[model samples]
Target: RVGLVEWEAERHLLMLDIHHIVTDGMSMSIFVEELLRLYNGETLEPLRIQYKEFAAWQQSEPVKERLKRQEAYWLDVLEGELPTLELPTDFVRPAARSFEGDVLPFSIDKQMTDSLQRIADENGATLYMVLLAAYSILLSKYSGQEDFIVGMPVSGRTHADLEPLIGMFVNTLAIRHYPSGEKAFLAYLNEVKETMLGAYDHQDYPFEELVKKLQAPRDQSRNPVFDVMFALETKEDNVQSFGDIKIESYPETHTVSQFDLTLVISLLDEGMNGQFEYATKLFTRNLIDNFAQDLLVIITQICEQPSVLLKDISLNGQSEQEQDVLEAIDIIF
Candidate 1:
């Protein structure tokens, strides 16, 4: 049994326990919702198929054909390009072996969230586009490269049958960003929206197939394509109670990826919470914290003043420190 207990100064301690098989981030959310609904006397129909069945069906021919198209598209897009983001390392980036990283989070107020949403709506774009634009600008500043790549997670559950079942139906797709001065923020966001839509239209392709088709070099030193991943999860109130046995769903341990960094944003009561996970061996905690804050500041500033140029977003006096770290890394590498 896996259990967690916490002590509070003002309130009594809370304890939680669950079987490993039934507990996961996604399952926890669903379980809490169902528990509440059941308590309210809401009867739900039985599920048509179990998760295992869905997994088996996912390996069928139609899915394979769709994946092939996705592989072809990615190969065409990434043909001969190397990673645009340059790391200050002399040693090659490691591959095959999985690495772990930690997360640093920054919070935004309700006003900021509302403002960003409004801007996105006004431009007929998505919140994802606004966030992606900010990320692109951040990458440009850090790497000193106007062209960079970010890997985004796509929900591969396109058909109705796959939605109810839980499995690893997630695919990573690379988005190439090129900041052209000729394009306005709104125009650039529109392009991103279109690209993402196209990606979704053909997301059934297996990522492994895409890698093979690209003939991506097998390097023990780095990831095949992109290192940074961005994900945004929509939030909901998830609380459960059975008489005196109350259980509140709160994130305990966050899973770290084998990439250099992963940026995740989830909605909170007041605003959005930004989380940044970085490889500890490659970066210091302070660096990760600063990077998160910088991205937040850039996004907030852009939302407040849409006319600002990409180059105008400053690190708020943190640039010197970042440069120092980069230089030290260069020397060590």
Candidate 2:
């Protein structure tokens, strides 16, 4: 019955220690919600399956076969492709190792989210595709490369058996989008939808194994493959309470990873929330924040004027901070 408690710090940070056997990201959310109820003197329904059951189920035969086939697909599709995007840099790029940094988060409004969803539905695509396409375009503009690569995480739970059992089942799929001159939004959306569907169709492959199969040249100079990753997580079952104790989540500071950079955007009924986690050694917090703001502006502009030229779109509403960041990258590399 390890529960929440406060840590001593100038700023607020909540701490908790749940045995690894009992919790994961998904379960932690639920545990928090339960804690809240209990602290307010309420009870909760018992969980259907303990964590070990889920872990054991994940090792079953069907899961293995699915993973094998997915690996084959990834090996074939990703073969011979340059694993990394050549991002323009102002300084000499650092070694291949990932660095730690901070996360800058922000959100979109409900009206915008609704509009984006409606457009996605009408276009016979998904909100995810729309976001991916926009990100591709942005990468192309920033890198001066027409073909852009981005890594996205998929739930990778195609079968009913795997849905209830979660153990790092998320697969990172590499999407390569090559934008042609003056392509229409619907056309781009169609391409993105197809790419996403194909990736989903073969997403059981573990990302680490796929990278090995691709023989992606390890570059101590930069990230091995893609420079950016996008993740969308919308659901969390969280409750917090314990006896007469109430619990609330204070913001937590996240250490950045070694990967080039990752922008995780989540959509809720209310709006969209974005978190930019980058290598502190590679980029300053201000640079990452500017990129997030610029991305929001780009998405908004595309929603209003999807037909705008790619170059024009990238250069739109360029703030001094963003320009400086871009220029710095350009000068460094």
Candidate 3:
């Protein structure tokens, strides 16, 4: 999926599509680092272990007990008939799901970013925790269910041995939160904080093993367990030069994803950027646009009144016609 957009035959946008199968988020950084080192003709030490060796060792007998405890924890946390959110879609959903999608890019102004950070600092939590709690609130508004699950990607590089290896060391963990209608948004952050800590502690459980341990009912039209995802992309301070031609980061052109909807918060030098990637077969651009705007509004609302109950928060107002369409599918917002 590589292409070139000609601009008067002087400049062009070079696009390259690297599938997640070949690598993941963290691997891309390592790939560029090694590529630069090789391009500079630097003498490097011999490799000690390859990705295949790491994979084989992961399934060895030494970590079975540790993995078993994680398996039990995940099984207990994710036990229930996972609710499939009835999101508003423009087109009819096909029996089989496709990866067709687009990314809606937005930015958080400096003021908003600063306010969010203040909220995080006051609550003794990271911005990621604040963002996840805000997203959970938005999801609860969209889907009328009080309890739901969201899947978040975790960097599964637990040991230093796998840091330099360009491989699939990323894993997805299901974070289930039961939003109490009476609790304040700040109180809810504590719940998200706890969930994040527990998930990281048990991250040694292989995702494939977790899937096998709890064989949930299969749904070809949607992904297993959870369909929504939230991730924060932190800026990496890597400057590599290949002779005189130094490599610079470019805006992402690939937007398609396997999930129903994914919200990626990119922390940039100027401000924070938000990208909403949703399945075109199951969601429309307008619907995703409303969601993106509503999420920002929710963040503002929470920052203003951290003590407000989760149920009392007001989402951005949508048109009556849009409201009707969403309600037709049981969506509240």
Which numbered prediction scores highest in TM-score against the true structure? 3
Worst 10 residues of 3 by lDDT: 315-324
Model 1: per-residue lDDT, tens digit, 194-261? 87777777677776767777776677656777777788887765654656456555567755557787
Predicted structure 1: lDDT: 0.71
Model 2 sits at a Cα RMSD from the real structure of: 5.8
lDDT tens per residue, model 2, 113-225: 77778778988888888887877766665666777678887765566554444344455788777865467666777888998888888776667777777786676766656
Clashes of 1: 5
> Which lDDT value does model 2 have at 186?
66
Give the TM-score ranking, best first.
Answer: 3, 1, 2
Pick the lDDT winner. 3
Separate clash counts for every candidate: 5, 27, 0
Candidate 3 per-residue lDDT, tens place, 202-293, comes to 98787777777778887778787788899998866445456764556765567577788899998977679898988888777888998989
**Candidate 3 clashes between residue pairs 3 or more apart in a chain or in different chains:** none
RMSD of each: 5.8, 5.8, 4.8
Go through the candidates in order and give each one's C-alpha lDDT.
0.71, 0.69, 0.81
| Root-mean-square deviation of Cα positions for candidate 3 versus the true structure, in angstroms | 4.8
